[model samples]
Target: MVVTATRTALASADVLADVSVVDAETLARSGAVSLADVLVHLPGVEMTRNGGPLGTTNLYLRGGNTNHTVVMIDGIRIDTQSGSGGATCQAIPVGQIERIEILRGPAAAVYGSDAVAGVVQVFTKGGQDGFTPSVGVGVGSQGTRTLTAGVRGAEAGWRYALALGRETSEGYNIQPAAYPDRDGYERNTASLRLGKDLAPGHRLDATWVYSDADAGYDSTTSKSSANYAKDNRALQRLSALGLSWQAKWSDVWSTRVMVTRADDRYATLPAPGAVPSYNTQTQVDTVLLHNRWNWREAVWTAALESRQDRLSNAGTQPRDTSRTQDALALGYGAKSGAHSWQVNARLDDDSEFGQYTTGALAYGWAFAPSWRLTASVGTAFRAPTLYQRFSEYGFAGLEPEKARNREIGLKYSQQGHEFAVVAYQNRVSNLITFSGAGACASSFGCYANTARAKLQGVTLSGATHMAGVVWTASLDVQDPVDVATGKRLARRAQRLLKLGAETGWQTWGLKADLLLSGDRYDRVTDARPLLPGYGVLNLSATKALTPNWSLLLRMDNVGDKYYETARGYATAGRTAFVGLTWTGR
Candidate 1:
């Protein structure tokens, strides 16, 4: 079948998987300021946030732990060094993004470890047929201002692109009743891509990206005033470089290989006298190889992936750790009669966790001219992170978490409209319940293992196009239960809703979005009340003044919704920004 953005990839869907594609044009129109804001509209995806731009946040899929999710950029895996399994979306700004693909549901059979929750893959813009340059600036509510500029296209036998952008905002409060000011943040990002056609059958590409942020954090509780405590400043810096090569031997065979390295550092300070401080640095090296072959009756793909991670921390105490993992996999897919079938198997070896083998089977059948049905089942596992197994403050020896997932979905596509619905369930084993801060109080306290958990959910997502405009909607409902205690998993939202619409013309663009989530518990132990159901609106517009120049305006949280998130932590209030851009080709 011909694959398009509107057509869901069914092979991954059977085990209760769903995926959404957001192209460059849509990314620009969403006025998403950040990666978190951009992904909020995806079905079955939610965010956990704390107070401040640099605060910790995790992506929750079907009520899975944040560490369960895996993020990839241009085929390069990006994860924290501490093996905390948490990926900070704030590390990369939205303006540099070309497109984002969200693969929902369980992905362990394909990606190994962290794929237990889902996979988010991002592709950056590269050289085009010609050279182009653009720049823009904008200002808005909350003392917000933004500046961006970029150049893309090709030159000689080599294609190249570069972008530089900055965002700054005056502070806001974590809550209306609290005095501790929140919000003030400054971000600088730079990205580059270079590619060359080496020969008739070979190509080479290189990419580099760097981002830095200086932001304030609310150290006190919701009721604390800004005057009583100093504004806590936090910083996150990330730099990555990658190279890839691909070659085609013939019409039936092809090969691709890549190598990538990344370094990330995080730190937080309170005015200067704070006794407690947090700082960590991590580095990772990854290599991947993929080969594909085609036959009259079947097609096959095989891959080998490996990575090494090193982490170090310094403050009151010093720590060091390292980990390495390798995976080999093969897949076979064939078309017969009116149905397409796919089977895959993989084996993983980790220095820390022995080895694991996984497999999946899927089938897709056409029910009608414009309708299709798909079903799949897969198993995934996540090895324990260094922090989870050996931390200075609280040490725990935990086994890897395992999950089995199954899913079925339906899809319809015609003209410029598409619709899809998916239902999935994931059962987890060996859930780790660390000692809560207040549980038994202090250093002597120890944590208990929950043993097992289950999460089930259904997601309905669709998009329609009319008069050069696209409207998208998604709703997710998940019921997660603790199999051991028969209680609900804390912080797992029962309902997640996202809706958005956008229109783009040769010289004009406009968009709006809304996000809401049901109430969730804060701490797993006490189950404290965190955020309530809330909704927010965002809007943006762009107008091309000339072939190389454009004007832009953006407003975030336009409705000024006041709601807590991530354990009742204060969030950014409504804000706005304006910018201009110049492009050359």
Candidate 2:
């Protein structure tokens, strides 16, 4: 289902945006433990982690800033409000997700604000047709262990699903050069979803998810502190709750109302005899109301949304602050013979940033039976984060970051093969950067709108099935640079390539993935050395012993290549995992 692109349920082929969908079955077969693992292979996507497993992870979509992307879980925004204005991607458990939708490029016209980059929406598992229960256990390298249990089914007029999971690991040393101590991690997660059909055209649904994690990390880089060799720890908690009601007034009209709340809590403890401990908590509440009209050749959508963000921290200025936003959006799509078009517009009033407007227009032409050409232009914006405006070194007068983007795409599909190529460019203004060169220089550093940037890229992707084997490949070539200084954006590679193959015979299957990344600068400066290129290979296999039981094995980092996505950070070397599962048919 396509929801992230247009904020409506439509077929993937009908959506006028670059989108990718990953289902639960695909996640299970890939043996991916984190959301980053699955997203890293997608086109126009990049991920950077500070260290192994439980590290601070960041995602950049189509060369946009880490905070420019919006993440939603079951229609609820879960972006963090602490010092870093990014989503808690590392804290989300994969087992609880039934599907993921990734939309690339500007989406502010449909989602507003942080959709400058794109949107990633996660949907949890729902009830099945009959009573079904499952359990699984696994052991992996670094003394890792995992346990999970879940049950879901439909009974009478009600449907419900519940899942619980736990994981712990005696992780390897993250900084073996300066700090040889291992950095372990532990996590617990629970998810529940319930839905009922009140009548033929009305429904009610509710969902909740809770996650808690504790992870160990190293101190700052050696150049920054003498005690950088010491070890530190952090604890995180996340909870999300959502409720929705839907009604079908008639065959041509439908409406939906939803309310959601998300809470994020984080605490950090210094190593022995080190700095003092600190904590931060963030809460977000949102309400949405939308109506849709579907006719023979056209569809129209209108939505109203209100959201409040509250943040409390022990180290930041103001200690507590809140921001509220109200938005209205209108969209229309139509199909005329072989040509289709879509237009969307949004108006937002933010308590801190004032009024803002954004819009997008897209067109598609089916030139041939199996070929299509598409083009789009859009505008997007990102409000300054609370920490950027209210922290001890923050600048309260900063303006919102904005961008205009355009793209053209060509797609072809025939038989069991599909291919697509898209080229896009984005120009950003009022770019916010942390600098100590202006009036706030004495404050160490403060965020200011002092720079501009341009990002242009080409993405190529294709998939084909032959002789019972499916092969997929994607390549991204881009130039992301600061317009004034002509410096490359930090941590964003100029080129990325991914290749994968999957094949199964009878009850046995095998899958392999390869990723290659070009050199990139750790900092956007001419003096910093470039981080060398790297490649990694992963392999996995599964064997079905019976109709109800299966065995799985996976090997990661087969070559044990040492690499770092961020300076002074260490990544996993060679690792392996083995597991078994039982299913009730």
TM-score of each: 0.91, 0.98
| Model 2 TM-score relative to the real fold | 0.98
Best by lDDT: 2
Which one wins on TM-score? Answer: 2
lDDT of 2 by residue, 397-466 (tens): 8899999999999998899799999999999999998877454423577778988999889999999998
lDDT of 2 at 392: 68
Error of 1 at 531 (Å): 2.1
lDDT of 1 by residue, 38-143 (tens): 7767888877677655467777877788878887776667777463556777787788889888877667667778788788877777878877787767777778
Report the error of model 2 at residue 368, Å: 0.3
Model 2, stretches more than 4 Å misplaced?
437-442, 526-529
Model 1 clash count equals: 30
Reference-based lDDT, each prediction? 0.74, 0.88
Model 2 Cα RMSD, Å? 1.4
